[model samples]
Target: MTLYLCLPLLAVLLQPALCLNCSSQFERTPDNSDLIVDCGTSVITLQINLCTAHWAGFNSSDLALNGNHNNSKCKGSIDTSVDPPVIHYQLPVNDSQDNPCRQSLQIVDEAPDPSGPFSAFSSIQSVIITGYIDTPRSDQGVISYSTDLYYHFSCRYPLEYLINNTEIVASSVSVATSENNGTFIDTLMMRVFNGSDYGYGLSVPPTGLELRTRIYVEVKAVNLTGNFNVLLDHCFGTPSPYNMSQSEQHNFFTGCSTDQRTTVTSNGLSKVARFDFEAFRFVQHRDQAKSSIYLHCILRLCEPTKCQELLSACNSRRKRSLTPFGEESNESATVSVGPLYTAREDTPSAAAYSNNMAPESAEDDVTGLVVGVVFGTAAAVALVLGGWFALKKYYRV
Candidate 1:
């Protein structure tokens, strides 16, 4: 009976041994024993090993039996997995409506490149002029001019308002002409209170004009009261309604040709001289008073040889005198040189040089600032989180 009671006592003591590997007691799994541990919502079964040394006269078999019977119970702890901080890559901010004037009217040959070397000359084949007209029932206006090597000119006419034969000027005239002689010319006139359905008529002399050289012509009509402006641009004939008509054709002025001659009385006898002369001299001279109309046309249609001679003469004159310093200065001087000189500076602005560039768009700058702030904040947060994790690991070690 005593041995039977001892067996029950031993069983009760063995229960504690089994509890040694309990999962709830410790975070790590027991080795070499029938034990189970919990690791963040995961169950880990472990085989725990036990070694015993019996003292003198102690029962080794009993100890072995106790060791074999040891067991454990464990319950896993709940785990909440953290989601990766969503790094919303602030998309590179950009403007939805960037109305950039990609095309520039300034002569590109003179513009400096933002990078290293100067940029190549980009030909401006055409130009589109746009404006808004409010008084005339709100209309958007656009005018385009094709590129012509011979004649290239641009002009603007301001709206003129007249009340009882009085001239009202709202905006000053805006005029730009090329200083490259024989390239462009402009003539301006305004008529007020012309008793007709049309409020005014702006007439330019040599109106139905034709040229023997490459030329560019432009005219502008402005109504001051209405605050509206109209422009007329003509390039000496690549193709158009402004092309040379049969009646418009005139004799090629060979006065400037070295091979041509006219009667000259040298020794009391009429002699034909072969001195070089401009062929279109008569036309140029006759139209001298009307250079605003004829210079471009003459240069555009002038024969190549004639054109070369004119260009050479211009270059020689340009080199000879330093009177014209800049584009506007040269234009003013050329126009003052009578009709022929004025026509040569037709594309005056083409020679303009300025140290200042056009202003930047406000929208682009604001967008860049906004994007910088957003990304900067996100990076700061990420850096703080990383530093915290590193510090925790260091302290634990």
Candidate 2:
């Protein structure tokens, strides 16, 4: 009697389950797989290892195109019975949308396939389907992001690696500015310390310092296609649109070239563009001035052959051994070696030299000249008078 009483209650609960089964539960089999790119057919089909072309969703009765999902329940499933289980689809492929940048495959349930046996499938549609194609790697790939290079410098040698012809490197850099009592002053100080003896193929420890008054420009570039060299073509400054005159372009920021690569040091790395102006030299030309700076660079991916050639050159340079100064042995040679000579002072003793006299006065010089002239004039007068007297006596005789 208890079992019979419970059966009524169980029937009530099971009623909803029966209705769910009776309703067609539409399902697309072999879900979530890559589509084989097909452009020939507009019909939707199914295959073991491909996406379905037509609506494979479930419906109790063949339903017309209506957006209502209450009519049927759709479930997604993956069938793995075949060698490469895939639900194939014959949806028309759009060649225009066949790129990594575009959305090639879109499965929509708003419309039905226009053709064939499952034409009544109003709940599913393949809007766009395209075959898989490998995308080309970006030539100028960004491994790390940084704006610190703008303000602070870092080491450039001992690069981590090269990607797309770009040398993945780090640098130690710094920037500082001081005002000379409201006067504009810019200075760049650079230094470098290498952990290894060989730095860019040099035995001497790498270290440098540079002080410039002009604004420094550091240029950096990467080839996007990996086909050309990265060249710093040009750099210019645009005046702060607001304060054009107050912010005159510094002289140092003139035409910069690709060859003007910066030499790195502790304070900062070499900038691609540097101004010719010094802190002290007075700027005469104020006609051409801009406040903001802009640099244009060109990038070309490097050729594999060129990279190999450069590597070979570097290897050869590193392999060349240092020549030894004439070989020396521990045993002394019979030939006599000259004694080291020390230079002696050749200057005379202070006692032997006369002391320098004070400079004579102009008045004293004038007085001496006057006295000599007066004596000379008086003697001449006396001689003239005596000669005249003798001539007169001789004439009388």
lDDT of each: 0.24, 0.26
Each model's RMSD to truth, in Å? 50.1, 27.2
Regions of model 2 farther than 4 Å from truth = 1-250, 253-369
Residue 381 accuracy (lDDT) in model 1: 97
- CA RMSD (A), model 2: 27.2
Q: Candidate 2, after superposition: displacement of residue 97 in Å?
A: 27
Could you tell me how far off, in angstroms, the CA of residue 45 lies in candidate 1 after the best superposition?
A: 99
For residues 27-142, could you state the per-residue lDDT of candidate 2 as single tens digits? 24423343332222222222323222122322212211112223222112344455333433222222233221222343333332233212332332122342321112224666
Candidate 1, residue 21: CA error in Å?
Answer: 99
**lDDT per residue as tens, model 1, 1-397:** 9999999999996663443322332332222222211111011111111111111111112221112212111111111121211101010011113312111122111222222111121211111122110011112346433211110122121111111100111111223343322122232222211112333432222332233332211222222111112211111111111122312322212112212231111110111001111213234335343233222111111223433443465346532111101122221211211122212223235343221222244566778999999999999999999999999999999
